[model samples]
Target: MKKLLAFIFLISSFAQAQYTINGTMAPILESDWVILYKIEGASQKYVQDSKIKINTIDVQGKKQKIGTFSFTLPKDTEAGSYRVTYKLENAGYVDFIFNKENLNFGFHPDYPEQTVTFSISKENILYRKYLEKISNAQQQLDSIQITALQNPSLDLKSAYQTSLNKVNSIQNEYLTNSKDMYVAPFIKANSRNNPSEILDNPQTYMSNIIDTFFYDVDFTNKTLLNSSFLIDKITDYIFYINYSDDPNTQQILFKNSVDKVIYKFKNIPYKKSIIEFLIDQFETTMNLELIDYLFENHYYKLPKTIQDQKYITSKRALFATGIGRVAPDFSWIENGKNFKLSTLNDSEKYVLVFWSTTCSHCLNEVPKLHSFLKENKAVEVIAFALEDDEFGWKNYKTNLPNWHHVLGLKKWQNKIARTYNINATPTYFILDKDKKIIAKPESLEDVKTFINKQ
Candidate 1:
């Protein structure tokens, strides 16, 4: 009986505490049978929270869906930990966002009128350290946002979530440390510096940053020698972005500014009690909303990656073709006109080697490369040649006997070599069917072995 009661209690504890979000209908959204988007991390595709029938639903009250949505303490959300994403595939035939549905331009808000703000002492080592952490954290978070911002989708949401978790953890730590009035400035500092690195200590670092950042584009002004100027500078980025012309530039600027602001307010002096106010008002309201925007940007950049996917394939094809990625694409261009990058990829199994005719290491690997090609018939060997003159290439090609071969964009200065950071003689990268890099700089045998297994 006791176990049963405990289990029941546990289940009840997991039940979501419900609340309603009231958004005034924009009239247009009211009539169309609307579907709510829990947009997928990394793109535009969204998952319909199948449980809910309508996006603008009436549980106890009427509400309208906003232009974009991110998961939060939704009114009906359950209490247990969830990895829910905002996505856009309603089984199949549905699109989450469309002017096809007819929505207006993305909303941009004006800056709120400035008024009272707090400052923390820079002299306190603990306070300085606490502030430094916040600043550092803000930078890490912002970088991730900027990286993700080239596109906005479910994957981006996941990445944003990772950053947000760190921020939340830091804020929670700050809340735990808030007994010290000294660190209270940090709580306010982070919230105040949203979308930018916190450059100032609450009491210092402000004046120079303002005099320099606001007016001069060079950003060559003196840094906060003292804590006071730092605090003020941190505040500037938060307040500034609402006024910037380009939204993309705005994201980077704000991140840089906020990192500086957190520098002065957090670290050792960080406290939990002081953090509650900031988390409630600052992090939750401003910074997080800004993160959502950046994630949308991240989603947009993925297609660029997708579009470029076709161009880069062979070790040489990828680097020479100008399809440079963290790891170049999986590719090949052999069998004369019949062979192309896409065709090689269709088989999903291949070893790509980028080498030069003049490369001694490449010369040594030739017979071994042929042996691998012979042994692993299922796996194709794509050998890219970096031959300055066609004569050396032809000679090297004739000598290479059987593995695939092709001349690169500029021989030694080939695009593939530069892109893959291959200043050396020979470079190798193995790829999976999904076009992800499995290994690089490995031996020809290692690459062949991998392809055979695949």
Candidate 2:
């Protein structure tokens, strides 16, 4: 009898342990649905929606449908931030923190003036108030700043300074009081220019700012993984620190940013997230060599849990066709004419363009590029369309008749695109007469700049 009772108690405790979220969407139609999104793999995507049901709930001591909308987190769900969005006309979404607690939110879909309201969750309730206070304070500060800038009087300047001081005070007070809350570190990370610090040394203000930016941030805090606030804070910290105009200086600054972030993130998952983000950003640039550097220095040093063999292989592939490396040549067959890349273009330089007719960006960039290259006889365009069919290319070929147009049989998995690692449409690579990659311009403007430099 004792054993059976203990077993029953354990089962009940496990069953009762779960997070519950209650929401009210006013002016909601019968067919309208609400979506729940949780952060997955360093980003958020649609998970599932609440089903429409006619139900009753206690609303101000009365039963109603408006109060009946509720959803429960999965039993296996981890504690984190979740976003609730109602797909009603002109209605946005609301975010709240959940950690095995019952939380409630009230919002209106059509009315912008009706701000989101929360109950039962102390952290979310404080976050909403903090947002409102910041919004109101910013509007007042803007008015004062405009007046002071337009009319530079001693009194106006003093008032502007006073307003800034008050804003900093409010932020500091919140930081002290809400230290345990999820939003506290975010507020501290964003707070800037206290009166004492500003008055002491203006020259070293930026250095001070960088040192204290992530002072309170707990890299291992799983709660932060549920929201984009942490990611945005990381991005701002890296990009805004030690900005420079000189390309060499800028490159060093960027490299340092990655190294600093890797050193700070003690948690394996968080470290992996940041490393992947940095790798992705570098992959878009001609500076893909940075990815190789990171892989060798930081990524390889990480524990095996984060640095799997497949991930290492993928990173190596990105570095294969980096800047200063010879552009890989491929076969092009069009109208029974087989030609290698080197044989097609006899100009001093060649512009290899990988585009698809179906892509909207290609539609705009291709024509602009064709018009831009009309007078430049020194550079020839070897355009390859990665298309499933030649119909779209044939129709669009009239506008671009000057270049050597080749239709790739496979759309994304084309043999040439695979060789060159062309993941995005309208990718441009500027090569010399020897087929050596000189520049891989990001956009049409970049292409023009590279051409002028040449």
Candidate 3:
């Protein structure tokens, strides 16, 4: 009976075991809370969240406030990469390996990833050391190779060989040591492909580097996908490797590199995730042409289940308002007669100005615009006023009788405002005779400059 009871106790203890992640931020973080997430393929699953506690501490004989937070993992938590996001602005977060082990670390909020110091967790510590050593070795090799290419007469074969040997030695040691570990795949995927022989020609060396960039990467590795490694690798290849002085040439190079990247992945889900990431990157730069290319070529080809229909519609709406595309049609009642923006043939050029009575800037600029366009008979001004009520607009429009006036109720929630994606008042869109957008002016002065130039 005693032996049986002891075995039962052991099993109970094992089943009840839980891990914890404790974080410390010096010069106290601005955020009041921190959230923990388990990183899966292309998304993060919420694990837990904690309210941060601030405490004063001594740092080199000076008092400093530090923020601390902790997250206790559930007993059945899976082993993989985890993220702690303390704040949303400026990407205030840190990612680390969690393999059913307690982790303790500290970092500065401003530079979380760069300033992080691990006090515990063998996996994180080992991974950090491996990255530092390998990065140093690779930098040395690159420096030597660049020097050799720059000065062809000077022999750098011995230096290049020494640096290359160091990189290989570090890579092999980490690969062997991290065997069967969660971080093993990351180290393997991050291995640099060094040239076997030094090439005097820069073009040849660059070509070789680009060709072997993805030699060690396994696109289907779940662990790598869950982390930021694959996204980072793809970003470097598409943006950094492919460059040109001319903007048109750069766009073509980017497209070619994107093709090479997409061809490497056979898994549909992984491919979709990568393409989505690329779309987001281009969206930030407002590269509408590339965005259209991605949707037409890659995103549209994906399965319907993965396709985001709402996002597709929104993007199409944006394209509809783009320069050279006909503006969305809208109708309004003026003098008890319906008038449509598309059917207006009375003027050679139309100025669509979205303004609000409550906006101080709009109040200041609209009068100036009305005065300036009074003498210009060829240009017709469509003053669309976004308002909550007709009281102020009815009284305000008396002074600008020559301009066609349209009232948009519901202010920002107005259909026309939403259609144009208007966030601020006094926004101007200059349209040609065909009602196609020509110039999106910033101010009344810009409107004058554009009209005067024409």
Candidate 4:
């Protein structure tokens, strides 16, 4: 464990952040002071306070005075998406200092007057905005509902629907016309009344857009889809997306790619639905055994939530994907061109190192790895950096010795991380001549030991 900690530490430039919290609301006679610092792309921390804030409420809920504290983001702080997160000792809620705009794109709320507009370049970003809009809009409707207690004439849903209608108009105009697949689904989902419809009936609504309907998702269609349509459409979509490959808009089509299908699909029917589908399909369809496909076969899809999602221990047993298990296939661009990885022929084995400059461990391990490769001139080490940071990774590239250096991926949570299950830093997996897993977690000692044994 100490070695593992040391090894992971090699990836760090040892940067840290500091902040000061100050304010007052009430007295804190019993609760302990808790100062927390949260960043976007990196981990958050709790530390001693040198900042200020309204005195937290005590156990007895008495009035208190205000005070302040301070902290800092170290000079070595890595350049990445981040934010300041905090919470008072007595308060139950956590406060976010960084604006939501970072996670979302074009998330404007009523810019100038009575109307608000939203536009997003990516599907994921659009989804966040869509969810946010729905939530906030509902809040407004809920507020109006308060009047219903007295007059019984207030229609809160009608009030909220009005706001959604305007949003729907914007979605209809942009989504259908755009080639972006997210546009269509997003507009379609928003045009419906509630997220429940999206969760319950993905198939029928999706199928109509593809087959029968002309794919119009404007305010014209107010009726939400039923459960039956959703299930059928989703199943068909799962298979359809699996087979079809759109070249013109190649990357964009991955918006709903069924590749990483999850258990959240069960959010609708956790109990009876999983079994019902199997029985119903078996009775109707030909040549099929009744079986729970996800849990029985592809159970990796069942994650309770994003952060604690059990794609690891619960996802069955996935090998480290070191050598065999088939190569972690990838294609990238380099030198103002394309066909980087694809150019490699499958006839021989290859050593691909997905790394980053900020990852200090890569600095130490890679050079030595390259030295070993140099001795075996026949072998190849494609050091494709997961980080595309020009200033960040480029500096490390200069000090490194001669070897193949590949780029393109800028995010740590890129395709490679997902494929390799790269939880820790400075990981080395070796492949045999046939691109089979020969060794993994090939520490410096492991490589030295293996090579000597060979």
Using lDDT as the measure, which candidate wins?
A: 3
| TM-score, structure 1 vs. true | 0.33
Candidate 4 runs further than 4 Å off = 1-323, 340-343, 346-348, 399-402
Give per-residue CA lDDT, model 4, range 94-124, as digits (tens).
2222212222111111121122122322433
Q: Candidate 3: what lDDT?
A: 0.89
lDDT of 2 by residue, 295-353 (tens): 77877888876677877766665565677777776777666878787665579998989
| Number of clashes recorded per candidate | 101, 0, 0, 40
| Per-residue accuracy of model 1 over 188-299 as CA lDDT, tens digit each | 4344223233222322334433434433221221121112233334344465533357767766655555444333333222211112222233434345434433333322
Name the regions of candidate 3 deviating beyond 4 angstroms: 1-16, 322-326, 329-350, 356-364, 376-379, 385-398, 401-415, 432-454
- Candidate 1 residues lying further than 4 Å off, grouped into runs, are 1-122, 125-184, 187-338, 345-348, 416-421, 432-437, 448-454
Question: Considering TM-score, which of the candidate structures 2 and 4 is the better prediction for this target?
Answer: 2
How many clashes show up in model 4? 40
Return the candidate ranking by lDDT, descending. Answer: 3, 2, 4, 1
Report every candidate's CA lDDT: 0.44, 0.73, 0.89, 0.44
TM-score of each: 0.33, 0.59, 0.87, 0.31
lDDT of 1: 0.44
Better of 2 and 3 by TM-score: 3
